[model samples]
Target chain A: MSFINYSSREINCKIVYYGPGLCGKTTNLQYVYRKTNPDQKGKLISLATETERTLFFDFLPLALGDIKGFKVRFHLYTVPGQVFYAASRKLILKGVDGVVFVADSQIERMEANMESLDDLKINLAEQGYDLDKLPYTVQFNKRDLPNVAPVENMNKLLNPRNIPCFEAVAVTGPGVFETLKNVAKQVLVELKKHY
Target chain B: MSGSDLVMYEEEFGKIDEELQRLYIQTNAKVVFLVDKNGQLIASAGETHDIDTTSLASLTAGNIAATGGIARLLGEKEFTILFHEGEKDNIHISLIGQRIILVVIFDSRSSLGLVRLRVKKVSEALTRIFNDIAAKSEREKSEGKIDESPFAEISDEDIDNLFR
Candidate 1:
């Protein structure tokens, strides 16, 4: 859910990065955190296990430019993608304004990617949100891996709805900004409807 | 947790801010804030100069959400109150209408009993105010007063300018 505070002239929206474990969901947020200037970003907090696997979530608050004189702030979050963290995943999806499904593009991880996608739909439905109607996009990450699936194959599997798709090597920051821009744009447009 | 975005108008904000100020003073709390279940900072008051209210709001919501999840697993409908104690400060969080959370951060000077007592009374007032705001927004939507063109002036180029 986006919070439009007319008194503060600030609009805050939450965007979630979702995918299977090791699909570069956290990497995407780190790239954005590193690139964002100090003034435009808040502290990045990661709740993770001892070995660095995400335990609950990773949160980053970023300020985008003004839209019609109102400062636009986006709270970027990443859900723990391990199947055992299903409950934490559901909590992260609550009140999400937009989602970037970062599918693992490695050939061997396709099933995991599909399972995560199904989980996303189920969690969203449990919260009364329809995946078909929510602002969504897909990112085929790990594109630099040698055994990655072809874009066409990944598209056919994940983007049957043909939502904007980007090939991202998130660790190197390629396609990260593009994916973020699209999701933020869609969120802003969605907010316009309620304005 | 609903899919709809939260729109706080000037009128609604004024009322909430006033109440937060009153609550802060009445209970001698160091800080008090209201947050949506989604972790959005709605309104806040008191000794927040050194606080990162935004981050606090987000983490508090997560904390409450995790608590709620545990409640469901135990077959409870909800756990409406939570308290975290520290050496210098303590936080009390309670649900208002199960949609918004009220958090009171107090130091050693104030007792938890006082904070909870004040919050119980104020929560009733907040619930009514929120209900009225929701009703007003719904009525406006049906009357076609909800304009969609406020964002027409924002272009894709404007958005791109942020990353650059």
Candidate 2:
């Protein structure tokens, strides 16, 4: 969902980066936080365990400039991807306007990717959102890894819907901005259609 | 936009601001703000210049969500209020209409009891205002009176310009 403050002339949208454990969801956020201008970004808050694994979520607020007179702001969030953190994941999905599923591309993590996607769909449904109707995308992360699956195979297995998918190494920031921009555009287009 | 999306117009914004201003003054608060459950800063009052309210809004929502989750585990509906005390300043957080958060930051000049008493009245006023806002939004939406989006004429190039 998006919040349009007519009095303030601003629009706010929430986007969630989701994937399995250690799939570089946080890495993607860290890369964006590092690259974005200070005026364009807010503090990156990570509620993680003592070992540095995300326990609740990581939030980063980015100002994506103005569309016409309304200043557009996107609040980016990443859920804790560990399987047992199902409750936390559901909480973070509330009022989400867009999603980026950061799938790990290593061959051994295929099952994890599949499960995480299924989890996303189910959680969205529970919250009365149809993933098919939202501005959603997929990213095949960790492309730099040696044992990665073929892009075509990953696509066939993961992205049957073929909604814009990118191959990315989130740590070094190859396709991070591309993925972010695609989803942000889709969100803006959706806003145009709605109003 | 869906029914759940928040649309704040000038009329209700003024009303909310008045209530927040009253709360800030009555409670002697350093700052008082309202944030949606989605972490959007709806409105704020008092001394906000030294604070990063954008970050504060996000973290406050996250705090509520985490606590709400804990509430579910214990078979509770939701935790309606949360308070934190520090050496010098204190924070009093409560849910308004189950969709918005009311946060009050104060120092030793005010006591917890006084803050709570004033918050109770302010919360009631804020909830009524939000209900009215929701009804107005729904009426406008159904009657096709909602303003046309500024992005109606947006192009791919226009979007790309933001990245630049």
Model number with the top DockQ: 2
The DockQ score of candidate 1 comes to 0.63
Chain B TM-score against the true chain B, each candidate: 0.93, 0.95
lDDT of 1 by residue, A1-195 (tens): 788787889889899999999899999999999999899999899999998999999999999778778898999999999999999999999989999999999999999999999999999999889988888989999889899999999999988988899999999999999999889888877776666
TM-score of chain A of 2: 0.99
My TM-score estimates for the predictions, one after another, are 0.96, 0.97
lDDT of 2 by residue, A1-195 (tens): 899999999999999999999999999999999999999999999999999999999999999798888899999999999999999999999999999999999999999999999999999998899889999989999999999999999999899998899999999999999999999989888887776
What are the runs in model 1 whose C-alpha is more than 4 Å off?
A: B1-3
Predicted candidate 2 versus true structure: per-residue lDDT over B66-95, tens digit per residue: 899899899999999999999999999999
Worst lDDT 10-window in candidate 2 chain A:
A186-195
Q: Which candidate number has the best lDDT? A: 2
RMSD values, in order shown = 1.5, 1.2
Off by over 4 Å in 2: none
How far does residue A99 in candidate 1 sit from its true spot (Å)? 0.5
